[model samples]
Target chain A: MTTQQLHEQILQKKSFLCVGLDPDLNKIPQHLLETEDPIFEFNKTIIDATHDLTVGYKPNTAFFEAYGIKGWVSLQKTISYINEKFPEIFTIADAKRGDIGNTSSMYAKAFFEDLNFDSVTVAPYMGKDSVEPFLAFENKHTIMLALTSNEGAFDFQTLETNGKELYKQVLETSKTWKNSHNLMYVVGATKAEYFTEIRKIVPDSFLLVPGIGAQGGSLSEVCKYGMNDKVGLLVNSARAIIYASNGTDFAEKAREEALKVQQEMKEIINSKF
Target chain B: MTTQQLHEQILQKKSFLCVGLDPDLNKIPQHLLETEDPIFEFNKTIIDATHDLTVGYKPNTAFFEAYGIKGWVSLQKTISYINEKFPEIFTIADAKRGDIGNTSSMYAKAFFEDLNFDSVTVAPYMGKDSVEPFLAFENKHTIMLALTSNEGAFDFQTLETNGKELYKQVLETSKTWKNSHNLMYVVGATKAEYFTEIRKIVPDSFLLVPGIGAQGGSLSEVCKYGMNDKVGLLVNSARAIIYASNGTDFAEKAREEALKVQQEMKEIINSKF
Candidate 1:
């Protein structure tokens, strides 16, 4: 999807919520286990119940990978479900994949062409060659890891690099690369203050914000600092939305949880812009 | 496989050669594509031909993922073939994956358990929790990205952070993690001198050195600075060895190329130790 298309979806939904479709067998509803594909079933229902309320859906690849070949099939099916049904909904293959130039081109092909995701998250450790391949895919987004919402983010991201924080330098240096206009960034919502500094570097670029709800960052605080005139933020809530309940009402409960976030997002959007 | 087992394999093979199995459909011989599964067929022949010459087999995951589900199945078959036929070879899934704590656990399960790779490469941008899960698996290894061989490595890795390079900080901070013992690192062979500094932080750790032939890193220089008492390096050469020839004698040619590297390694080992 184009940035303009995503922006229109945000306006139409009155929210920038991206429900993370991270399915785990240990956490899904018991009844679904009887089905041939429990993971896809759970995701199908959740997407059905809440597709309109959110602008994006992120299926983290690791969760699917854990189950092996069948898990990969489930991932493919879930993505196909989204693209076929909710074509307007932005999709992210939350693969956290990056490698050398040639290897990275394969990853871009897997997510953008083969799986047909609108975007794929990439790690920044490999630098421009790893990132530029993903960017080379027309209109497909490459969300590079910046200040993540984990304790590990402090390990290298926050450390000062060349008179600035490493993450800040990542934010600055990436803009000069080829096809960097296709870049979006993954900035965790855990630290509201980081958003203030982050927005200063790349004010126009959309930031895919995870770590709200389950990770406990205020949506209002994230918006107060991170939101731009274009409403440049995708606040992701995974566990608190998807696994809201393990009962048969799992998807409905997920919708209810997502509804609460979407409603809050509606309020935040109306007030800000 | 345990680190001790890897050390033993290096001793027995008299080579720290890691043959990178990165089979591209466009690059493989025309005859292989006529088979039921070309990628696996190519990998099977290569493994059969070069099993004794190398101690490690690093299958970069991006190549397989590009082919979609069939590719995933092919990957499963290739790894299974290796485990059954060449049980002594240390397998490295060159999938540079890392995420938040819970998500990372799934990746750990995917590579270490589901696929049964001996080690998997991880991007360290997410910090401690992202890496710890991979280390949690018994006898499995997590090869963290340090200074990489690609041009992109200079983007953020070399940027000085807190008085040290970001990659250096990744090396230093990671040493304090829960399973530091299970950790190895990816130090590109391109800059052999970097090994002098990397060894200071991770003197005992095994370094998975890539960029030997295809990316142009000298093996002899890599060994001079990177080798330790146990020969502390799994120097990888993928395209130069595997794509040595696209003829009917492809695997034999691959074996010949591998033999050359193995011979060089044999000399390096004899001279160093």
Candidate 2:
């Protein structure tokens, strides 16, 4: 999935919300615990409920991975379900993977060819060889970590480097890498103030914005500076949506929360253009 | 595993070699392709051949991830095989995973709890919340990407931040994070010159050094500067070992390469103390 297709879907749905599937086993309903695969069952219902309201589904790999093989199976089923049922919805393997040259190539194959995610979140610390492999895959996007939304982000990303912030330098230097046209960036929603500056460096690239819902980042504040002409933003909400309820109504409540975000997104999209 | 355990193992083996399991499908012996699971078969043989010569096994997750479910299954088998047969050998899920606080906690659970890897490579872009989650796990270590081995690493890692290099600042700041006692760092062997400087800040921390062999980094130079009193270095050799041969003798040739490294490491270990 190219960014262009993502833009068209946003236009069609009038929403830019990306529901994050981060299923914590402990937080899941007791009813699901009775099932053969609680994670899969929970995810199936959530996808069933919220597929229409959102343009994307971002499954943070860690949540599924915690359960070991069972969690991984659930993750595969969730992506396969999204692909088969909601082909138009963009899918992200929120696996922040990055490594050296040869290793990065294999990672590209894993996420792009094997798991079949539209994009995968990657760390930029290893630089081009690590990142370019993900970008090399045709139509696949690489969401590089730019300005993250955590307190530690202030430690290094925002530290002044050569009279400029390091994240800003990451944004600027990444533009020169091979196949960078396929690049998108991960800019935390909590760092909304940095968006104005980030936008100047990556004027046209898509930004995967997390930290909006459970992380307490304001939707309006994120949109105020992060959105571009093509609605270049995928605001992800995990706990606030997926774990909205601990009962059979979990999926429906998830949809309700997703719907609320989609409604806000509709307004934001309308106001933008 | 803690750096202390790793250090003890290095001393006992008289080798600091961390043989990287980055089995590229195209590079594996053609005979293994006849098997139902070529990747696992190849990895098992390599592990069996080199287990005694090496102190640690570093599996780059991308290699297994590329093959899809089968690849991940192979990874599980490979790691399980090591754990059951050679429990003393340190295992690293060379997965540079870093994300939000909650998301990172789940990742920690994935590698440490589910998969049972001794440690994992983590990106430090998100700061404390992203990295601290991994460190929080008992007996599990987080190998934070500090100075990487890539052309573009110079672009950001070397950038001066308030008079200190960005990588230097990362090392200094990481010390203050919660549960930082378990934190290790990734210092590319290619950047051997910086090791003397890096050791100044992170004296006791273990450094996972890649960029040997195929990447043209000198093992002698790396040991000269990177080695601490505890042999605080895990010098990794991936392509040079795994792809040592494309014939059925691949395992034997891998053993030979691993032995050479072990011999060098033995000499280094003897000379250092």
Candidate 3:
């Protein structure tokens, strides 16, 4: 998906929220467990409930992968459902996949061809061979990790080299990759201050910002430093939305939570326009 | 598996060969296509024939993911077969997953908990949040991509910052992550020249090196620069080894290729030790 299309969606919906589909089997409503595929059922209801309020849906691959084959099946079903039903909404396979050239090419086929996600989160650690393959696919974006929202994020991402943080170096270096125009990055919401510096490197590229809601990051703070001319921020709220409730009204609660963020995004986006 | 166990197996077999299970359906033996699961059948034969020579089996997840559910089922069967028969052999789920804290924890559960892989490849772009969750798993190693073998690898990986390559920064920064003692790295064989520099920062960590054989990387040069006191290199050969013969002798031919690499590895080990 192009940044322009994402910008259009944000304007149309008046929202910049990206709801994350991270359904934990144990945390999902008990009633869903009775279904043949509880994970997909849970995801479908949430996608249905909040599709209009958000510009994109980010499905964390690990949740689906945990159920083994069943989990993976659910993931495929959920993605197909989204693609078929809400064609305008961007879909991200939050897989963070990267490998050597041939191996990475196959990954490109898996997510872009077979499964048909609009983008897949990739790791930039293997340099460009593993990452550039993902970028080669037309219209597909590669979301590389920049600054993350974990205690250990300070371990390496914040380390200074040549008077610049490592994350800054990643952002600057990415600009040189082939088809890197499609490159976006993951900058966690918790590190709101870093966005100021990150913007200097990638002023226009979209940022898939997680760690809002459940991770205790302030949404307003993120927008203060990270907002671009296009409102280039995909703020994700996973557990805070997917697990909002564990009862029959689980989907409704998810919508309620999504609506709250969407409402806030509307204000933040309007202030910019 | 731990470096000690991997080392012992390498010494016992006199081989440092890691056969990559990048089972391309189009490249499998034609006769195997007649089976209930052609991919599984192809993998079974290859494992049976070359199990003695190889200390590790690295399955690139993209091949299985490409076929959807059927491919994943085959992967399960293949891994189960290996674990049941060759319990001592190391298994790597070359998945290269990375994400946020909560999301990454789930990925760790997917590979380490559900799939039972000894190690899984991870992208370090998301910083510690994406990487630390993988490290949190006991005895399971997180193989971060340090350097990769591909034309585009030069794009971002080699970019100089602070007079050091981005990959060098990744290696140095990764050392500070929690449970990093269990961490390994993926340094491409084609980038053998950088191995001497890589070794200076991470002399003790095991490296899962790809890009040999079909990738045209010289094994001798890699061994010369990449090997450490523990011979900490798991050199992977995929297409060249698995597709050595696309006939009934495919598996046998795979063994032949594995044996050749194993013999060379033995000589290298003998000369070094």
**Candidate with best DockQ:** 1
TM-score of each: 0.99, 0.97, 0.92
lDDT of 1 by residue, B213-235 (tens): 98999987888888888888999
lDDT by residue (A1-273, candidate 1, tens digit) is 899999989998899999998999999998999999999999999999999899999999999999999999999999999999889999999999999999999999999999999999999889999899999988999999989999889888888777888899888989998999999999999999888899889999999999999899889989989999999999998999999999988888998999999999999888877
Residues A1-273, candidate 2, lDDT per residue (tens digit)? 777889999998998889888888899898889999888888889889998898889988888878877787888988999999998999998888887777888888878887888998888887888788888888999998888877778878888876788888899889999999999999888877888998999989999998898888999988888888888998888889998999888888988999899999889888777
Residue-pair clashes, model 3: 0
Clashing residue pairs in candidate 1 are: none
| Number of clashing pairs per prediction, in order | 0, 0, 0
Return the lDDT, model 3, position A148. Answer: 76
lDDT of each: 0.92, 0.87, 0.87
Off by over 4 Å in 3: A1-3, A161-163, B151-169, B193-201, B270-273
lDDT of 2 by residue, B106-151 (tens): 8888899878999999988878888888988878888998998877
User: Between the candidate structures 1 and 3, which one is better when assessed by TM-score?
Assistant: 1
Better of 1 and 3 by lDDT: 1
Could you tell me which residue pairs clash in candidate 3? none
lDDT digits (tens) for residues B79-169 of candidate 3: 8899899999999998878766777888889888888999998876657767888899878989988777777666556766657777887
Highest lDDT, which number?
A: 1
Q: What is the DockQ for all candidates, taken in turn?
A: 0.92, 0.79, 0.55
